[model samples]
Target: MPSRWLLSILTLILASAIVVACNGDNENTETSGKETDGGKPDDFVTLKMIMPGDESARMREFVDNELNDRLKNDLNMKLELTYIPWGSYQQKLELSLSTGEDYDLFWHGTPFVSGYKSKGYIQPLDELLQKYGQNLIKNIPAENFKLDQIDGKQWAIPSQAFTSAGKFTSVMVRQDLLESVGMTEIRTIADLEAFYRKMHAIDPSYYGYLETDRGHEVLWRELSGENLTAFDERNLFAVNEDTGELVNYVESDLYKKVAHLREDWVKKGIIDKNLVGNPQSKIDQENAGKLLFRVGAVSRAMENLQTAQKADSGAKLREYFLAPDKPRYIVAPSNEAYMIPAAAKHAERAMMFMNWILKSKDNYNFIIFGVEGKYYRIENGKIKLLTNDQLMYEWMWRNKNYFTAPTNVPDDVVRDMLHNDDNAKISRLFGFHFNEEPVKKEMAQVLTVYKEKFDLINSGLVGYNSGFSSAMTALKKAGYDKVFAELKKQFNEFNAGRP
Candidate 1:
């Protein structure tokens, strides 16, 4: 309670800081009204974008003093980016979209665009692309654009900038703990459980034996060796890649297998019963050198290793890919995106600005890596990032063609990240967009049920037998059948139509 209270206090302070900084920037928008080539200043459009993360005076200065100054001359457009702390991002994002006060568009994260589209907060970008985003269509592959499309209409610019070679889940274990247990590697579920047991015996005070930021069902599916693609996220619904059958993943035996495994780990004192929401808890513990394991993808492990080293210089962590025998699937380039609000006052300018960013490799790289000398520099053909925080929200604009890895990164990472999605298990539904429009209310209610009942079950706090049945019953009452039916119908048609 005390920690939550303190967090709440900090959230308010950060929110207030963001508001104050935004106000100052708004009053300081002298550059947003820069003159055009023919001396028409009205041609300049200032696109307002809302983002997540705390206010950074450094970033504000870089955008206004440097980035915007260049944009005023080249594209005749400017950007007004506002930050809302992660704690209050969704709430504030929805509020801004609902009100349309000082907001043109905002970041659209995965598993969220569906909800936003259902609520009519964001608009279709089909016409916008035809008119102003032509450069985007020319540069970005058609398959990549489908990531942000639903009902065959693009709702936002795709957020993938990596090679999209494919996505596979991996685990990061504390090497110190492994060596302490006289173990070298963990490649099996049995090995994982044994490692946890020995680690718990040494220090039961450690949180959970495993903590993952990735979707639970997807992670477990990889471990279970199931041929299922959780297209709807969090194992709410899935399509069997082999059979093309759509069904409720939660109701499948695969769900029961992993749930029971997690429960067993919990019973054996390997998993913490007091599971917290989100991967941020794991991040917090890792910073304090208390976390035992972290799970996500290969890139996630790489990022985790960097953060762990900063948290503890002596920290020894090793990354291992789960289900190594199976191919990693590429569903989309990335799950990050930015969507234009339907009520955006400058929708055309928003499209033009984004299109301009992708018009050239140099332009894209400049936006991401920042000034060549200050934020980054190339040494021996490799980029050296001087400040990681200069543009912390640069993930939203990742373009594989323009991506340059820092010197600290491994060459294989750079190679894999920049490649096309050909070498890996590309999903049959790679370009298939699931529309929740027909069953919006049902999906919402079922998702609410999932949050309330399934979070604990998925976290391994309780055995599947203890609560899984009741949750299924609740889901059925919440119209899970309708969702499943709709998904099945769509997947069948999509699969049949695919070449």
Candidate 2:
């Protein structure tokens, strides 16, 4: 009773102390979460992306606004895309990768994909993918994943659009030209050669077959029933089912025979002499009505001709699929992919953005062609027309995936072509990532020599006979034998793991 006032004061002090302790505990829990979970939603984080130029206004806005906004709110991150023109993209990409630049997410292709993967520039997405990429794993099937896996890890994501080789390789002939020549039933590559001879003999003014200088040599290998030893740095050859051993194209006699055939065609003046360095050699000749037929990818050839026809009513393009001519034409993965680099500060966020695009058509189009009204306009229920010249070259590089897959194209001709083609299997190659770190060094030297010499031969720089021998010698010297041996071993291991 004598200490009542003192007791009340002590009680008030203890109650305040208890309140402070509870508040401190709450703050500690939140601080712990922030440290482990990256950052708060409102925190500003910038992700750098190097991609093709933004020539389209609609496309530019979509990247800056729609995509950025969605990513910021959903993943607590933002994107900063650096525009590199397609002509200089490879140079810039190589420079960035070599110098260890602090950027993330590269649109990889034949040279870039293999080159970067070999260099160990990307992270294996196995662990992260298993945890956060559940939807992605479900959408992409096991068969597709098996193709993308290198060694034992996933390096890049395949294009979800048109994974299968849809009647992939075809002869783009001017049907009108064939009808004019009375050659109605050209089936084999030999038959086509006969047509070429007839066209060249009758009128020396036109080339019987107008071919690009880059890949004509390789194409000849296929046309002549010669197996090619095409492999990435992973020492992986296209799997040979007959002998269970890796097939090296240069080791076979058929390769030399194919070279001789190309030389014969060149001697006959059937192929242009000055075609090697000219990027537009075939297209220019075709436009000038100086070409009877040309070789190209089926879907691409048809689309290009359709675009040309829109300008010139007389331009005609039709495809003769290789399957009808050759029985064993298996479509394999083309060397291109999209991936998040290991250095990506926002890799998780970037992956989320990619998954969203896969799920949301609106988002995909925004990344692809830009805002619908600005770059293109929907004419009817099924057509999208490019409205301006500014939008044309905007899609030369990074936006190719839009046209490749799940997005709806309003072009009836393109849609019909896709539906009819056999190689449009986007879901098949989704999960495969090949790892070639062990044989990378050996593969690099061999690949460099092969690419350089092969380019010259296809361009008609050296006599096909001598060129073939020189190429073979260089390949053998560069360790082609060791590479194939390793490839067979790894392939067997990979197959054993598959169900």
Candidate 3:
């Protein structure tokens, strides 16, 4: 009924309308793919995280079924984990980062922090943390965050554990051995020594102390109350509490006393001679129920007690602070932290994951303990572990502030040690981080000298004064003076800037 021209115009109009309508539909679909809450679409991201430990098959299953399901539904992301054994962790991490591997996150510690930051292997987290890590900022204290900063930029987010302000050193003694020795309590180092001597005297076959090469270093730190600064990589330097001057920790009076005591103990048959080079001997003795006293961290004490109980039902354990009179707590620079490499493609997503983990109790608990009904169960407001077979490595993503207490330790004991109000004295040099750049060469030379010379003195194989003099002479020859001067200058600068 219409004219030919009118019919042609109508056909063009319909075609234009269809094209505009299709364009509108495409725009709507694209917008829908992005979430309004800043999250991505389902299955849009797969994050790779490398951690230190053997990968648990059970954990992998749970993550695939339980964790990924939730992450996919909520954040549109999933996690891929690569576990490296402790011995191979450092080497593998270096290799992975150097090769520009596509990793989103990894566990970091003190030894790696300075090196990683200085070399620009990791990115500053200031903006990412501000945008997505509000929960972390709220939960962790501002001062605690200062520990992760290098040159005024944050490179890592510290795990929610006792970083630098908790009781670390404690002596766990065998209760049955103490009772046999007629000792009720060990209040001081002298009391402990007496107990050890009595145990040895009662039974010549029983060793008084099971000493380990690394345990001795912790004991020395507890006794000296001096933090190992950058200049003291070998832990041979201490700051004078009175004058704040740098002093050789091995040459100090306290160190001399402890070293002499160790020497006397070694001669008196209190310490096993094989312990000097054989660190595993301590573990062997502990399992054999021959260990009388062991010095280590509070959690280690608890773990030892558990191990001792499993070995001998009659075994009982008691803990005591080595320096109860002057409780010294060093806020450690690193515990457990999540770091994003500079080459990571999913930096924002990694931070989002961290923020979500910190913010959600269910998420954190799931990561820490595993699937609630399967791996653990709640009993009377405490977590009762169901099986140790496929346990989540707590240190990998633990937040002690919101952690649930395990059944292996009493709730009260966990609270007392974790919230150690009585002995929560922050060190005078609490937040000081030693820049290793200035003295890198000196540090390497000194470390070699320390292992060759100072380790003997520390292990009580050599006399204190003679070994100290010899080690000091070697250190001086290795340019110890230069290292000390640089450290002192830095310390002064840090002190001047302290608020």
Top TM-score model: 1
Report the C-alpha lDDT of model 3 over 398-429, residue by residue, as the tens digit.
Answer: 45567666666655457645655443444445
What is residue 287's positional error in candidate 2, in angstroms? 9.4
Identify the runs in model 3 with alpha carbons over 4 angstroms from their true place: 1-43, 91-102, 161-166, 174-184, 194-233, 268-293, 302-318, 389-392, 395-401
lDDT string, candidate 1, 1-499, tens digits: 1245434533553343333323321111123443322232457778788888766666887898788987787767788988887767888888888776757767867667777877878877665566556567666655566566665456677755565433535566776678888998767667676777777788876654565224353356455556666664556776666666775678888778777767776777666655456545544677676676756444554445455666665656665555656555666666777788877877666766777778777777677667888878898877777764645445566665665566766665555444423345655566566778899899889988988888788777767988998988998999989988988788788778643
Model 1 scores a TM of 0.81
**Model 1 worst lDDT window (10 residues):** 21-30
Query: How would you encode candidate 2's per-residue C-alpha lDDT over 229-299 as one tens digit per residue?
Result: 23433222443433444456555554455456566677777666765456456556665666666654535
TM-score of each: 0.81, 0.70, 0.78
**Candidate 2 vs candidate 3: which has greater lDDT?**
3
Which regions of candidate 1 fall more than 4 Å away from where they truly are?
1-42, 165-168, 172-186, 194-225, 268-270, 273-275, 278-280, 287-292, 304-306, 314-319, 392-394, 415-422
Ranking by TM-score: 1, 3, 2
Worst 10 residues of 3 by lDDT: 23-32
Return the candidate ranking by lDDT, descending. Answer: 1, 3, 2
